[model samples]
Target chain A: MNSTIARLTATGLLRGWRGLLLALLPFVMLALALLVRMAFGIDPEITSGLLDTFNLDTVVPLIALIVGTGAIATEIDDGAIVYLLTKPVARGRIIVTKLLVAITVTLLFAAVPTLIAAIVVTGAAGTVTWAYTVAATVSGIVYCAVFLLLGVLSRRAVIIGLMYVMLWEMLVTGLVDGARALSIQHWGQSIAAELAPDAITASLSLPVATTLAVLVTGMAAWFATQRLRSLTLAGDS
Target chain B: MTSIHIDRVSKWFGHVVAVNDVSMTIGPGITGLLGPNGAGKTTLLSMMAGFAAPSAGTVTLDGDPTWRNEQIYRHIGMVPEREAMYDFLTGAKFVLANAELHGLSDPGAAAKAAIDTVDMQAAADRPIATYSKGMRQRMKMAAALVHRPSVLLLDEPFNGMDPRQRMHLMELLRQMGSDGRTVLFSSHILEEVEQLASHIEVMVAGRHAASGDFRAIRRLMTDRPHRYLLRSDDDRRLAAALVSDDSVVSVEVDSEEEALHVQTSDFGRFTVRLPRLAADHGIRLYDVTPADESLESVFGYLVQS
Candidate 1:
C-alpha cells in the first residue's frame, strides 16, 4: 500500500477522457431515473427494476472493467510501468496499491452514483439504496481486481471484459439458467438479496457468494503481483 | 566503487536469442554498449537493470543477484528507451512522483535538484505531451536521477536530441562518471560512443564481439582485410607488380570486368605501394576504389572474426 503508487494510479485512471466517458454511465442512469419518475408517475416498483437491472447489474461491472484495466494496462502497453517498476518498492505492494486505487475509482464512479440513482428511483423503500450500494461495493472490488489481473494478462482486456459481461453474463446466462451460477452478476445479485430478498434473485447462498467473491478477487490480485514480478519490458525489436 | 557483473548471461525469447552467452563487468565510470540495430543492446541493458531475468547465469551488483531483487533498485537508476512516462502529468509532478516512489525523506528538494540537474526547471511545470523529443528525454533523465542511485543505465539516451542538448547531456554524464558513479549507456553510433565512452563493449548480431578501450576497438574495426578494385591500362602487368608486394595478399586479374581485384592484409602498406608499383610497371590507373566500407560490414567482420 504505497501512497505514491496509489496516487499515481488514481490520477492516471481519472484524468483521461476515457475516465470521463466511463464515469458518465451512472449519472446518465440517475438522470434517466429522475425522468422516469416524472414521466411514469413515481412508481417505486418500476424504479426498483431500473436500479436492479441497470445500475447494479450494468454499471458496477462495466465501470470496474474500464477503471480496473485502465489502472495498469495502459502503463503496460506503453511501457510506462517501467517508471514505477524500476523502484525498490515490493511488487506485491505495488499491485495491492494499484488494485486498491482501481477499486476506489470503480466505487466512486459506480457505487456512489448507483446510491444516488436508487434514492431518486426507489425513494429509500426497504433500504433499497443501501442494498444496491452494498451490491455495487462488493461487486466493484471483485470486478476491479479480476479485471486488473486481466489487464496484466492481455492487452485486449477491455474486449475480453466486455464479452464476458455481455455474452457470458447477459446472453449465455440469460439463455441457460444454470450458467447464472458462474456469473459475477449472480454474486452481486446474491449480495443484493440480503438487503432486499424480494428485489433480486440469488443463485447461491450469501455465505458462498461472499466467499467466492473474496477468494477470486484476492487470488486475482495475488496472481497479478506474481505476473508483474516476472514482467518483461520487451524492447522495440 | 559500484560494479555490475553479468556472468555468462543469455536471454532468449521464443526462438530468437537476443543476448548470447556473454559476460562482462561494468565498473564505476562511463562504459558504452555499442551495437547496430537489433544487436541486443536494449535486451542487455534490460537484464543489467533487473527488468528481465537472464535465461542462463546471472547479473549482479557487488555480490547480490539483480533478478527478483527489489533491493537492487536502491543502487541503480534506469532510463528506458521508450518515451512513455505518464504524459498527462507536469514534468515537476512526474519527477516528484518518482522521488516519492524512491521513499526520499525530502522528495521536493530531490525532485527540484533532479529537474535542475537535467536543466529542465524552466519547462518543469509544462505537461510532458507538449515537450519536444529532446525535452522529454531530459525529463526522463530527471525522473531516473531523482533517486540519485549509484549505477545509472540509459538505453539510447542521445536518440533524437539536438546538438546542444546532446552536448549538455554528454557533459552531465561525464561529470557523473568522474564522480565515480557507474554509468552505462547504449548507442549504435560509433562517433557517439567514441566521444563519450572511454570504454566500449561492442555487440554484433547479439554476440559480444569486442570489449576494452575504444582505441583498440577502433583498430580492430579498421584492421579488417581491405578489398580494392583497380582498372589499369595493363591489368596483368599491375597484378604481376602488386602480387610482388608483401602487403598484397592476393591479386586476381578479372578479364571479364577488365580490372584487378586485390585483397590486402596491410591496408596502409598497400595504399602506399599501389600507386608506386603501378607507376613502376608503367600501368596508368583508371580507377582505384576500396569496397565494403559500410559500418555494418565492419560489424559483420567483427562478428565473424
Candidate 2:
C-alpha cells in the first residue's frame, strides 16, 4: 500500500550479493536455453525436456525461494525491521509492500527469463514460450507470497523453504500422482498447458488449477499479513 | 505529551518469567531503567517499545495500548539493543529510508537533521558496514530520531561507546529530556544512570525493585547494613576498637585470614569513624574493601526491601 516502503524493500533486495544471486538463476536458465538452441537446432522435444525438467521444475522454485525469502528475512534477521515496525503504517501494508517487491524480483528473475528461454528453445512453432512464461509468472507470484510469509514466520525460513521446494515438490510430487495436484508447479503447468496447444503436459484441468492457484495465492498473502501482525521482534526472549 | 504506563505487567517465556508483575509510569524527562544484565531490562523496554506483548496487564502510551498497535509508533521512537542494522546502506540513506517509512514529506531534510543531531553529518555518506561500533550507534540514533517521535526508548545506548561518545550522547539525552521529551534509556552502570536520569525505575529478577529519583535509590542502596572486610596491621586492635563504636553493629576477627569482618548500619559514619579510629590508635590499615559491592547485591537488597 505504501509506495515508499515498496521502493525501500526493493532497493534493499537489489543492493548487495543477494541481487547477484537473483540474477544468476535467470542467467543460468538463459545459458542452458542458448546451448540447447545451438546444439539441438530448436527441436520441440528438446525444448519440452529442458522446460519441463529444469525451468519449471528447478529455476522457478529456486528463484522464488531466494526472492521471496530475501524480501523480509534479511530485514528480520538483522533487526532492521524495527524501523518499519515502529511506524504508524499498518502491519498488513508493510507485508503487502514487501510482497510487491518480492513479486517484482521473482518476475524479473524467474518469469521473464523463462519466457526468453522458452523462445530460444521452441522457436515460433509452439506456444511453449508464452505457456511456460505465464506459468512461471503465476507460480513465481505464489511462491513469493508463500515464501515471504514463511520468512516472516520463521528464522529458519530458507532451510524450510528449500526442503519444501526440493523434497516436497520435486521428490514427493514426482513419486505420487495425487501429490502433483497439491503442487504449485503443477497448477502453474496446468495454466501453461492451456496456453500451449501441444508443447506442455498438465496434470489438472484449467478451471481447477485456476481456482486453486487463486485460492492458494490469496490465502498465503492473507496468512502472511496475519502472521506479521503479531510478529514479535527477535532478541526479546 | 506521550507517557508510557506499565500496569502490573508480567511476561514469561515458557516457564521463565522475564518480567514479573512490574508496574511503572514513565513520563516527560529522561528515566533510566537500571539493572544488571539479564534483569529483564531489555524485556521491559521491548514491551514499552511495542515490540513484545506483556503476558498480563497492560503497557499503554497516553491510554492507547502499545502492543499490536502500529499507530502508537507515531509518538514513539526506539533504539533497540541489538547491534545489527541494514549494513548495506549509507548512514544518511538508512535514516532517509526510516523517515520515508514514517511517511515524512521531506525525508531528505529530516534525515539530514537527524544525522546532524547525532553529529554524524561528516560520516553520513559512508556505508554503515564500514562504521565503527560508536559510529553505528550514532547512525542508529539518527535513524530512530528521523521522525521526531515524542517518546524515545533506548536500550543500552552506551554499550560500546567510548567516554567522549558517551558524554556526547548523555548530553544529547539530557537536552531532549529538558525539552520535555519522554526519554527512557536502560543501562546497568550505576554512574551512567545517576549522571543522566533524574527519575529511575530499578528492576531486579524481573520485578520493579525501586522507582524514584536517583538520590532516593542511592539512599536505599546505601542505607542497608554494609559488610566490609578490614585487613589491618593489628586486626584485634581494629576489631576491638570498632566493636565499641556506636556506628558498628558487629565485628568478627577472622584470625585465619588476618582480617576483621565488620557490619555497620550507618555506612557514612562508620567509613570515616573506622579509618579515624585506626589512625588515632596508630593502626596501619592494609586493606578496606566492601564485602558485597556488586550491583547484584545492591539490587538484591533493594528487591528484598
- Give the worst 10-residue stretch by lDDT in candidate 1 chain A: A120-129
lDDT of 2 by residue, B183-226 (tens): 99999999999999989999999999999989988998999999
For candidate 1, give the docking quality class from DockQ: medium
Off by over 4 Å in 1: B230-240, B253-260, B275-289
Model 2: native contacts recovered, as a fraction: 0.66
- The CA lDDT at B128 in model 1 is 92
Q: Calculate DockQ per candidate and list them.
A: 0.75, 0.61
| lDDT tens digits, residue span A1-237, model 1 | 998888888888888787787768877887898898777866857866787677766778889988999999999999999998888899999999999899888888888888887777776644667887888888888989999999999999999999998899878988998887778878877877888787766888999898888889999999999999888886875
Model 1 lDDT, residue A157, Cα: 94
In candidate 1, position A162 carries an lDDT of: 91
User: What is the total number of backbone clashes in candidate 1?
Assistant: 0
**Candidate No. with top DockQ:** 1
Tens digits of per-residue lDDT for model 2, A194-215: 8885877889999998999889
